[model samples]
Target: MSERHPRILVIAEAAHPEWVSVPLVGWSLAQALRDVADVHLVTQIRNRDAILRAGLVEGRDFTAIDSEALARPMWKLAETLRMGQGKGWTIVQAVSALSYPYFERLVWQRFGPEIARGDYDIVHRITPLSPTAASFLAGKCARAGVPFVLGPLNGGVPWPQGFDDIRRAEREYLAPLRAAYKLLPGRGATLHNAAAILAGSRHTGSELPASARHKVFWLPENGIDPARFNRVAAPGDGPLRACFVGRLVPYKGPDMLLEAAAPLLRDGRMVLDIVGDGPMMPGLRAQADGPGSGVTFHGWQPHEAVQDILSRAHLFAFPSIREFGGGAVLEAMALGVVPLIVDYAGPGELVDDSVGIKVPLGTREAITTRFAAELARLAKDPGALAPMAQAARDRVTQHYHWTRKAEKIARVYDWVLKGRPEPKPDL
Candidate 1:
């Protein structure tokens, strides 16, 4: 008798061919496990052209659920106005009217039926806890007698201790909103329903309940395809070209980068290339376009373009303090761009003394000073950059490869099904 390969179902809002890291991780896992397991992916919606280009066998192995049928009228209204015109009265009104019904009808209604029909050994519900999606999927998976896995890989971000401090400091202002959102039906139920949880980093793993902690797995959110991130000798160029690729958001710290680059601009030691778009773009542009603005914001580019940009750059600047998985950091590192990360949760786990610089976390001045110093040092000695860049590439090639990540995930499925003990790696 032959051993049966476990059948796994990955449920997420996004899926392959999309440029986002979460979807790309799902795509990579599905492709890696196709030869071994019967893998099926169910996502809300995606670009057909991108999925096709990813070379996934659609319908045969990968499938997407159309929630358009279950979508409420108010949901369309919210999306149409760009989520309440991006803020203020419109945002509050739109969220109040659309948030609940949107989750209950569009997400849960479609996700529940899919879970009931699919005989999956393990159901990985990505990022459903934020809303009511996880709770709904948990109930459906329970009915189907399958284990449910929760985490950023499936879509739950692990908040760090520093975040807790921030929450505590802002609790007076934020508690009411948090309480109101928690009051929504199905919030606590989701956390209670999950069978296992996975975090993208150690900091994230710390957020899980004591009971869920044992089940939690720490894996990077995305893996690199080595062929794509290969290292080439540095050009030993003029001013070091530093790249920052991601959504320009307050939490991402693009503003911090701009502030840091201000002094560097005066000295002409570093040039900043900002690639991405978000609510903070206008303000970031204002800061970068000023008299001493050395930063160049390139709105947004396609995923491939970002990769090409990383390959040509000398370093990657990622100052995000709220991120759970710094996919862009890993992507840049794989392409031989030395990553300068804040010594916070996500990036701290990916970078160390050997691979890249981990700056101490602080407000604008502290962060900017640390980053500027590192940039200056690297710019003066280009030879020092190659070793760290090579180490970064090697780290991804050896430990964070998609095949290895998928295999570990597959083992977790086996453990959930057969009641096997967890595999312990060498200490």
Candidate 2:
């Protein structure tokens, strides 16, 4: 291992920036770690061209392992079952669970010899962020004497009890069945051998075996890229511009935000910019009608455009019911747009009192009423916005930037390899 920095072999089976959101984290984290660590990313062959386009040289910065022979069959099955994206993302993950072992097996087969020969200082599994995807290579790393780090793994966020209707609409029938994953093969070994396990949310951490909780670190999976989110909101003199950026889906709760904001929007007291498209778009548009609905649907804008909208808006409103990672919330915070999020899963972990407003989970009507009241309070008190916005931006800058998260990873590496003590618990 080089004395300059720990040589990290980052394995991400699903890293592709061109795809939807989750993979972006993989790309961002792997790249950011290069800022402080000698990082060599290893991902599936599917991500090769995109990785190459991102200017990462082959063999130098990363190694693309092709496991398509095994993965494609599982992928086809998931697709055949009409479960691919949006409401179907969970089913895709279910299929991924079946195929991930093969991906890791290939990685272990390729890198096992080097790892055994002490070629790297750290072995980090940065993706399959789902905590249920137990690492097949953990035992190999343990036997080889190189420390392994799993996570920031998230998932296992239960359906909020009162939202039975929304859960049905989102087709989250398997959510209740998620507990069965804890009984999957290798989970015990994966937990026992890891030097550190970073849980992305309290829900995920609680799912860890009680004996392994000591190894758990509360590190949220979502983080902002400062360069992309450098714009500060300029909330103008007219209507209080509030924006919601995410798929227009049931779980994302865009409709809940709209229902809550309806009164404020009707009076022209607030305007909303909904920057995404999904199955919920048609229904959401129907709800956006009256004179001052003030809702502008910029259907599925590019990443740059979403940032532009966030830059001009005053507040970011998102009320996802079971969010595993609220990366969008951090993006808003990074842009100095105060976030108004549901106080439940991932967003609950990322936002604190000083940075953002949290609406306690409740029945649909109760949550909508509470959410609207918060909006009305913020609207009535314009002076409160700047401080909250500043704090939100400051929070992300200090704790939720990809580079900042990478630096934290470096600290975890130091503790694992240099015999330093674990950082204090987040509670």
Most accurate candidate by TM-score: 2
Model 2 lDDT per residue over 149-207, tens place: 99889887888888877777766667678789879898999999999998888888888
> The CA-based lDDT of model 1 is what?
0.64
In model 1, how large is the Cα lDDT of residue 81? 48
TM-score of each: 0.78, 0.96
lDDT (tens digit, per residue) of candidate 1 on 325-363: 677888887777888899876677788989888988776
Q: In lDDT terms, which candidate is top? A: 2
- Model 2, poorest ten-residue lDDT window? 80-89
RMSD of each: 5.1, 1.8
- Model 2 error, position 258 (Å): 1.9
